[model samples]
Target: MRTEETPLGRKRRARKINRVLAETYPYAVAELDFRNPFELLVATVLSAQTTDVRVNAITPALFAAYPDPLAMSQAAPEALQELIRSTGFFRAKANSLLALSTRIVDEYDGVVPGRLEDLVTLAGVGRKTANVVLGNAFGVPGITVDTHFIRLARRFGWTNETDPVKIEHAVGELFEPSDWTMLSHRVVFHGRRICLARKPACGACPLTTLCPAYGEGETDAAKAAKLLKYELAPGREELLKKMRAGATRAELRTEGYGLQA
Candidate 1:
């Protein structure tokens, strides 16, 4: 941040950046595939130090065997551990899951609590995990200060706080509480797809004029475009364009749209 920047200046800048991010990634949401609060809680717990894609891959079988708190609470330790083995730290994660599930069943009647206070009391559930569950599952708003969020928060000059709790509170003051959850998604999406840590696609970014760290990454349009990574990948927009032009899935697949590694 420059010496001339005020708290008000930072606040306005933060909101503006989020507006651009919201427009750029309108489809952003929790990447973890889950149907209910219990599933989301379980997925979030397993997501520590791992990618959502990896967690999503294993949840199907894990859920198939133990779909709820009561069932999961009764799962054999080894069986539960094996189900989530791919997410790494399987033993510790299994312990958390078992402990939390048992607590939920015994205390909360097998239902995931919606309030942050209660949610954080469960094993393996911290503020980040609690916020994710509250925002996505219960429609309660919260800021989730994960790694991506933390990195982007500082880059955006939203806050200087290094602590997750402080970062969450600091950034939370910049936008309305209602914007908290979606703002988190948008910031994380931008971090993952554009304002990356090592090689942000600066020239391809929508917020180039607003970003203070504009020249920190690739600046040439062509080079920055190549640096872009997204769920749609480079082929996503092309596929969407062709689809909008009336291309069918089978036809698109034949055209190699879904064949990327």
Candidate 2:
């Protein structure tokens, strides 16, 4: 099939995808549990390859002991590793966190800098982390291109490049700055629940009509069958049923349920 490449065609597809995603996940927001900029910075660093649930579980204890940059700066590397070991990459993550905390304490007066330029200067804080902190904690406009966002952007034909900077620029140019945070959240929600990396259920996906990669579903039959073997938990089933029965996405999130479909 011929793919969409023209500017008008791309814009139309993006607009439709964005509108449906916004409606599908009206309450989309950050899944990481954090109360402040520092906590968010720490959580984002810990969430490198870990699930939000896992990060959330670990942070309560981690933050309770080292509540701020000053406290965390003085934390022993081994002790910090023990606390976040479950998130994987313990040694590297621990060192990064320690260095980040020390820099924040000594340089920024123990405060997470709101500016992207300054935030990216911290250890382990890349463009994605900087954008997350800016958008979520400081209310600044930023487009965070995480794995989900990148996958969905490519799937939807927003950009053909694999480099994140190009993808960020493409998306940033397409959508208004004000929509950056909300758009990122919505795209992430859709990616996690529908536009998954493997065996995306495009038939039921809200953005399938607008997505160029919709027909690429189930390229591997073995993986597709394996996906079917994993069923949602009883609680998750109840939550999906409730959502189908007219519960708002916000209400479901408030009740501690994530979008699974």
Output the number of the TM-score-best candidate: 1
Residue 232 accuracy (lDDT) in model 2? 26
C-alpha-based local distance difference test score of model 1:
0.87
Best by lDDT: 1
Q: For residue 137, what is the lDDT in candidate 2?
A: 95
Write candidate 1's Cα lDDT for 169-247 as tens digits: 9999989999999999999888888888888888888998777878889999988888777543575787646744666
Misplaced by over 4 Å in model 2 are 1-4, 218-237, 240-261
Which clashing pairs does model 2 show?
A: none
Task: Evaluate model 1: give its TM-score.
Answer: 0.90
**Residues 54-172, model 2: lDDT tens digits:** 88778989999999999999998899999999999999999999999999989988899989999999999999999999999999989999999999888888888889988999988
The TM-score values for the models, in the order shown, are 0.90, 0.86
